[model samples]
Structures are given as C-alpha cells and as structure tokens.
Target: MKFPISWFIGLRYTRAKRKNHFISFIAIFSMLGIALGVMVLITVLSVMNGFERELRERILGTVPHVIVGERAQGVTDWKSLEQQVLQAPDVVAASPYIDSTAMFKSSYAGTEYGILQGILPEKETKVSVIEDYMISGSLNELVEGEYGVILGAAMARNLGLWRGDKVTVLVVEGSTVSPAGISPRYRRFTIQGIFETKSELDSRVAMIHIADAAKLLRKGDKVSALRIRVHDVLNAYMTSNYLRANLGEDFWVSDWNRSQGPLFRAIQMEKTMMFVLLTLIIAVAAFNIVSTMVMVVTDKQADIAILRTLGASPSTILKIFVVQGSINGVVGTIVGVISGVALATNLPAIVKFFEEKFGVSVVPGDVYFIGFLPSELNAVDVTVITAVALLMSVLATLYPAWRGSRTRPAEALKYE
Candidate 1:
C-alpha cells in the first residue's frame, strides 16, 4: 500500500528511539494521562448518572407525584377534590393526607422531630412505591392497630427503635384546648414497620394511620392535602397544572418539583460541577498532545526542510501532523473507553467484591445514600466526552503543523 512520505516519516518520528528516548517517554505518559483522564471522567459521570436514576426510581417513585391542599385555614371537602382530580388524565392514584410537625420520643432516645404523614393504607398503596421497600412488618399493621406507625430506615437509626418498639409523639397542632389553650397532647405509638427509600425521605419523614393523624391534629375528619400519583412522573407538572386549573383558585397543588425541589436541584448541580471539574483532568492531559507534537516538529526540522525542497506542499505537512495527533486521540480514547465502560458497568459488583474480601465497605452505608458506589454508562455522555477529546486533539496539532510548514528549505540544510 502506498502512503504519503510525510505520513510515513511523521509516524516514524512519533515513535521515539534512543536519541529521542525522553520524547518517547513523554509521548507515552501523555497518552496514559489522556487515557486516565477520560477513564475517570467517564466513571465519575456514570456514577452521577446512576445517582440520578436511583433518586428518580427509589425516591420519586415513593413520594407524591402531586399534592393538592387548601391554602388557607379551614379544610374543604378533600374527598370531593380527590374524586375530581382522579379524573384528570394520567392520574393513577390519589389519597388524602394530614401532615404536621411533631416531636417523637422513645425509651432509647428522645427529641426526634420529623414530618408525620397520615396515610390510609389501602389508598396510599396505590400512590407511593414504599409498599415495595418495606424492610419489616406490613402496611396493613397501621390499618389494624390504632397506635401503629412506620418509620424510615434512617429515622429509625436515629431513634434506636425497631419494629414492635413503643414510641411516643407530642403533636404540635393539638397544643390548644377549647377552653384551656396551649396544652400539648401526647400519644403512644408502636413501630409497626421500617422502610428504606435510601434518600432524604428516609431521614426526615414517618407515617401513621390517616384517621389517627387527623384525630391527633384535631382536624375532625379532615385532611390538609391529597397526594396524587400519576401514570407518568415526567408529566407530573402537567398533572399539577391540570389539577390546579380544575380545582379552582381556592385550592393549591404541588408536584414532585415543589416537594423535592432543593434536593433534585442540588443533585443535578453537583453532577454538573463534578463533570466540569473532572474534565479538567482530560484537558490537562490533552495539553501533552500539544507539547509532544511541538517536540516532534523540532526533532524533524531538517527532514521537513528536505521535504519542502522535494516539492511537498505546506498543506501536506500540516495534514501529516494533524493525522499524527489524531492517531494519539484515537488510541487514547479507545483504551479509555474500554476501561471506563468496564469500570462503570460493574461498579456495584466491584465495590461488593472489595468489601467482602477486605471486610470493610468501599462505600459505607453511613456516609452515602447507597452502601455501594453506583455507576451507569450513558451513551450520550460517552459520545460527548469522546467528541471533546477528539476536538482537543485536532486543536493540539495546529501549532506544531504550522511550525513545520514554516521550515525554511535553505536554512534547515545549512549544516550540510
């Protein structure tokens, strides 16, 4: 196969021998650096993607898709409102709830404040996915027993309480008596079950029977909000808008965005920041491409001059360098892609293997939301990363190629 003399010479020069041994090592390191950077960036970004996916599945699946409530004091007929909203397109399940801030206490520890949501078991199962992640006991326990309560895994950890353990709550809403005002009401509850959502919900919220929570709140058979679950979460905002338009101005509706706004935004922003920061590694490594090509031009100055005297065009010289730099990009990118994909696709298993062998968690449950680091290789993300690296590689060639083109045929041969 015939090849351009410039390409043949360019490639040969790129492979450093004894005289240019240091250049060879620098070239190798540059390739490795690019590989490492691309690998880490892909791996970290994949993990972030995994976190986002888990949040959507485990947290959003169990939280309300949309919540409708009366904005002002007195409670309207939520049951009637629920019926109307249920008829909205894409709304799958709707349940009434009474939410209030309360202080919970137990024998082991005291002073745990959290949001207590009153849910009707039968109705709630249709709405939230918590029924799937119940670690212990049953949701039916709440319906059967008046004093039954369910706690999130993290909240349970904080209280040092477990299923069948007795817990007491001081309801803030019931602090006022009809004649005797500002008297706190206390109720004893048994821990019926524990749930593991592995998100912020696990640390901050607990559940009880709807009737019991309403009674405790002194709402007298009324609910402050109706939690609605839709067939599609991506369309949650649409559902909220539909409910708001139909329910009129007196009623207020909240989507998952409103309920978990800060958390979702923070996660997204952190992921973005991580990708940006990690890309710097790739950028730094790519700089080596520029340096390597520059050195190559210096070492081959005489050859370039000879080629210029032999009728080779400056554009051809430029193409030669560009091609050489691009080869570096291609080889580095391929190696990084393979290794990074392997690491990401198997992160869960990799962490598990290390934890079991070493007898210590790589990703401890206490620190992160998951006990292991999660990773997901997204095609779009990989494509974007590769594209950026390729672009950087192309850019790196321009200076060296231009320098090669400017070689004076006469001066370069003066030593001869």
Candidate 2:
C-alpha cells in the first residue's frame, strides 16, 4: 500500500488548503477553464458531424452517386450499360435516366425553369430515396406514355399546381424546322406526385417517366445516362474514376463530386477551421496552469529546501510538481468529457426546447436543408480532444516544475 515518496508528498500537497486564497483561486480557475474548453469543443464538433451526415443522407441520397454515359449521343443500349454499371466495384444499384433542362409553365403559376429528369419508378427507387419523400401520390403513377410528372414541393407550391393539374414542358433540344424559324418542342404533363426534400433541389427539380422523356426529347429508346448508387457515398469519387478507367474513353463516368464537391469541401474546411479555433481555448487554459504552477512553486520554496535537506533530489521535487499540476488537468478533462457527451447527445432536444420557449426557429426549412439542429457525437473527436488537453496540461507543468527543482536548499532556508 506504500506509494513513492514523491507521489505521496505531491498528493498531500495538492490536498492541503493553500494559505494564500489567491493561489487556490488561480488553480481552480485553471481547472474550470480546461473543462469549459474541452466541453465546448466536443459539443461543437458533434454538431458539425451531424450536419455532414445529413448532407450525405438527405441531400445526396436524392441524387445518383455516380453516372455512366456515352460521350457522343445518348446511351442507346442503356440496359446493357446499366448492367455494366452494376458490375463495377462498390456499385449497389443502377438505373437509366434522361436528364435535361426545361421550362415548366402552369396556367395558375406562370413559368419556371428546372432540371427535368426521366426515370422508371421501380429502378429509381433503388438508386434514390425519392419514393420515401413523396408528399402526395406515388412514383408508380408515372405510367409510360401517360406523360405524368412529379414536382418538387416548392415547385408545386410556386406553380400553384396539384395532382392531376397540367403543366407544359418546353425543351430546346428537339426544335422543329418550320417556316417560323424553328420552334421549340413542348408537351403537356399531368402532375402525378409531389415530393419535399427540404433541400435546394426541392425548388428546381422535376421528374417524369423515362419513355415519355425519350419521346419528348426525340431520343427514341436511348437514355442520357445510367445512374449508379454505391455502397458508400464517401467513396463515390474513387468508384467513379474506377468505372471511367474500365468503361473506356467512349464512355464518361461522373460522381456526386462533380456537382456537389465544392459544397462538401466547404463544409469540411469549415470543420477544420472550427477545430483549430476551438483548440486555442484549450491552449489558453493550459497556459493558465503554467501561471498557477508558478505561484505554487514560489509558495512551496521553503518546503522544497527542507525536503532537499532531508535527502530529496532535484528530480524528486520535479516529479512532485508535475504530479500536482497534472491532477488539475486530469480532473478537468474528465469532467469536461462527461458533460460534453451529455450535452451533445441531448442537443436536439435542447434546441427544440429553446425554439419552443422563444418561438424562434434555430434552423428553418426555407433557409437550410434541414429544419432542426442536429448533433452526432463521435468517439474519435472525444479521444483527440482528451489527448490534446492532457498533453498540454502535462507540458504546462514542465517549466514551473523545473524552476522548483532548481531551488537552492541553503539559499531558500537562509531566509527562514
């Protein structure tokens, strides 16, 4: 049950109340600072993680992970191309699609431009979660030749259209040569469904049956591309490159990175910046430990001289101070981690409570992709924060401890 002499004395010194209340106050302040820094870092990082997850699951989930297409002309043999796409590594599902920009005009809502996409309901379900977000009607209602269309919720609201309402689609790809200097091809489509993604896409995307899109565009049986969903969205860029290499130069393979890379990259950069900025809080707290330790060393000078007289070495005095300073860091880090995790796990509820109490929305659906603040605690984030705090704490003790160790036994006791 015997402890090392240095450790025993260090523990005793830490437990004893300081005669100088100011020194005690500094020590307590240092401990609290470390705890606050760690807690804020953990909670903020968790919230960022949640936003990234939502981007992948909610926003990207509605779009294809990868697209395989012919460089010249549409994919005439889309069925075969779909099969090839499915054979590629990481490919989970493949569906043929015809994507084009078109103007949609409704009698009640006027006109708006958006991406018009053609899809087979059954196959589309495998590549995207559009079916899950349907607010009314269903993708199955998009019968071939029926010219039925699905509109985004915002688009539908703006157009003042509902199920069975008619909208005219105008495309410039298949204009006819008339005496009136070529006319744009157009078609009337009945609204079959409406979906709400709560994303930017909700205002600028529309869908219809593949056959109808092909006919409207005069592409015959050909499709613009084969949409591929991968097992992991994070690796879509690599998977797309692999497909491109294997599919040859005649075909082009693209992934979500082509369209959404900038957005996600911006998010990642923000996360990195936040991590760097927040770490300064912990660094500042660690500095406070230095000042606190310095004061302690000054107060304990006579004690150090007495211990040295009793055969304690300089190294022993150093170890004693290091142990004492480290205790503050250890206790603070433990408290911070516990509270941070608790706060992070319940962040959504806390946000909701505040919103309800104040009658103000923290995240509005119109302004953001999601309507509520989200949080996802990561173990790696917690571990890294803990390691940084502890390292800083231990490092902060070094200079003060070294100074304490250098105390002259004769000089220190001469004053007493």
Best candidate, lDDT = 2
Model 2 residue 181 lDDT score: 86
Q: Where in model 2 is the C-alpha error above 4 Å?
A: none
Error of 2 at 181 (Å): 1.4
Best candidate per TM-score, number?
Answer: 2
Which digits, one per residue and each the tens of the lDDT, describe model 1 over residues 185-281? Answer: 8898999999987777787788999888877888886787888989889789998998888888888888998777788889889988988888788
**Cα RMSDs, all models:** 3.0, 1.6
Candidate 2 per-residue lDDT over residues 1-416, each given as its tens digit: 88899888888989999999998898898899999999999999999999999887987899789988999888989888877777888889999989899999999969989999999999999989888889899988999988999999999999999988999999987779888786888999999999998887789999999989989888888899888899989999889989988889999988899898899999999999998999899889889899999999999999999999999999999999999999999999999999999999999999999999999999997788789998999999999999999999999999999999999999998879
Please list the C-alpha lDDT of all candidates, in the order they appear: 0.83, 0.92
Report the Cα lDDT for candidate 2.
0.92
TM-scores, all models, native as reference = 0.88, 0.96
